[model samples]
Target: MQPGADDPWSAPVATGPVRATVTVPGSKSGTNRALVLAAAADGVSRLRGALRSRDTVLMAAALRELGATVTEESGPGADQGDAEIVVTGPVGAARGTATIDCGNAGTVARFTPALATLARGDVRFDGDPRMRDRPLTPLLRALRELGAHIDGDRMPFTVRGTGAVPGGAVTVDASDSSQLVSGLLLAAARFERGATVTHAGHRLPSGPYLDMTVADLRAAGVVVDVDDPTADLLRAGATPAASTRRWRVEPGGPRPLDRVIEPDLNSAAAFVAAAAVTGGEVTITGWPAATEQPGRMLPDLLVAMGCRAELVPDGLRVTGGGRITGIDVDLSDFGEAAPVLTGLAVLADSPSRLRGIAHLRLQETDRLAALAGELGRLGARVTVTDDGLAITPVPLHGARLDPHADHRLAMTYAVVGLAVPGVTVDDIATTGKTVPDFARMWATMLAG
Candidate 1:
């Protein structure tokens, strides 16, 4: 079924342990980042296995507007291995006048504006209603500080490009979103003086995403230097130390790349969670052996909550123990996975405290508040904390959940519905923002 086709979807309750081998689509994060870097690269770049979700489509369209020639080798519904996106970089010839619609995609909204600054004309950016409310000022202010002429502080603003950006050092407060940092660093290579970004705020949210950005840059032959004090501390399970993080990108645009994108691990987490909540075993194929995707933390996150996660030759397999124990953990690195994790928390045998994700409030929706309210509608005890959510297990009953137009929330609500009968989710179409054909995929998994 298409997204929103079943408006108030009665979530399918798991009648038995769900067993399936699922192959999820390519990574949205990787697809958009590749698109951005490719658009600024020195030669033609080809992305195989690129996700064809709404977000990536918008990113491709945005780049095309800026004079990049983006061509899909196959149809929109092509198989993963056959789907290829060939992007002809527009580094020196970006069109000056174009109107870009971000369409509620954060990467599209935040990352595209910086690329637009390199054009020699006017580039206007706007998005869905909620995009107006999302945080873009930090990135916008940073662009203005870097010698680009900008008209406004947020969406519905225009970036007046002079064919080149006078890029230099700029300190930004990226406490609300790491995209602010990634956006600048991605386009730094084309800047006249290169670019250096220093984070001047609380611990940067989604620190690993910055690492992914750096990795993508390096893979495309761009030179980057990073100094983050909290990296080791956070990995060791200690609270972050107060210190600044800095990244320097040299003034040489990226070389073209021919990359085979990895499957979307954050999206795969939903299916894994389905296994955990239903005492089932689900294997997600094409799981990367090594990567910087923040979803790498999913296996450990599940292991801590009474599930067995192992990486066999076939893929990453998660087997539920039939009882979920509560977990108190900080999810600052993978905030995108919070919604699905929150779904697991509500079904746990005890209390779960998820901290270090205060920045979620500024996302597509106020996630912490939305989770508390939606889960509470089904009789789950969820409290909103300053930085996270505290979920106490209770006998949850079925109720129609509102996802607030957030893709992750819709997937989360679907997870909760697997264990509780009569649970319905409104706007399941929102899941299309990342995972296309989600209804059919979910049904297929249960069918097995």
Candidate 2:
């Protein structure tokens, strides 16, 4: 087994009871949309209780690059203790050309280009080397077809907006990331002519998120019409010009948000799987019964594996008593939870076959290969197909687990290592990008 000491994760330790109240952060998707909307709107938008994660930080920085004055302060009121971001619209035209470094923030990488259409001069969009390599060809082609001048089809690309965008029917293959489609839809609302987007292949993976984007656009005074089973369309029937606008963002924290961020079912899956693997009980609260986030399927899937999952008033409670069983399930909607599911598969009593997950290969890392490679190192018999993973349960003799510098991989493997005998990860600090207190929270849960 290859030691994953070179990766960014910590050594795994034993875990105890998983009872704890976790106050997850605000929704990354919502925060990004609010930032983009605030930037393009005419007035000073006060976004209260925004997420202060790496991804949101990147979006805020990108907004600044687009000539918006962004200021960060604490709370709706001085006593709330929640963070507030105030964005002043572009003074006149975007003052100067700027280079936006999106880092590994896919939201910034995808959405910033659309905002670039509003810039006065050329805006160069780039990101971390890994991010630069991620495919943006679909988005570039769509934008160019819409009359935006994009230097290259890939990153390190230059975008010069003519202050006007011509919209038409654009076909986008969003099999990689839904952010591409969302970006085009957002930019289309501001187009001189309306835009209609047709999915080139199978329907989008995160349908709920795409719906959320449309809902948010409507909230910002943009009229969006989503005719299901047909191409979703946005018609800017008339140019609705606003002199200035003010938007108050919902506050942050574990307390119920006006716009409750659907429980991070993706994150909770790790703990749920951890409890399953360790033959213990784990309960995650605040998971909405009606959540659009696809990751919310964790409890149902865990229950299929013979784990007892009960949906309580606040959240889902999971208990593992019998041996873990593997069942075939389609992960098209819940693609983000694939990493954790792969880890769970290794602990199952029978061979676990996950299907409808071809999109996993395109995430932060080639997740399918990364999972297979790392899990194989932990003595699991894992095989990868074009779509999903097929794994036969084995006693996980913890070897070094590499996170491939991806946050999801890091956290998922950390949970696996904790339940196993000896597992250590390299570069654990990457968890700070999303769930900074992952280790602390895990420690607290285990302490009880």
Candidate closest to the true structure, highest lDDT: 1
**Model 2 residue 410 distance off true place after TM-score fit, in angstroms:** 0.7
- Whole-model Cα lDDT per candidate? 0.89, 0.70
User: Per-residue lDDT for 1-448 in model 2, tens only?
Assistant: 1223344444556545455444454556776777787777667777765666677788888888778887877654222112577877642255477788888888888887877886777788888888877868899898888788889988789888667677767777776777788887765666667677765655466666677777777666676665443322224343322111111112111111123234355667777776777777777766677655666677788888888888787677788765678878888777777788787778777888888788778777888999999888888888998788888887778677767768788777877776677777766656555654566666666765
- Which 10 consecutive residues of model 1 have the lowest summed lDDT? 74-83
Deviation of model 2 at 41, angstroms: 2.4
Model 2 Cα RMSD, Å?
A: 7.9
Choose the strongest candidate by TM-score: 1
RMSD of each: 2.1, 7.9
TM-score of 1: 0.96
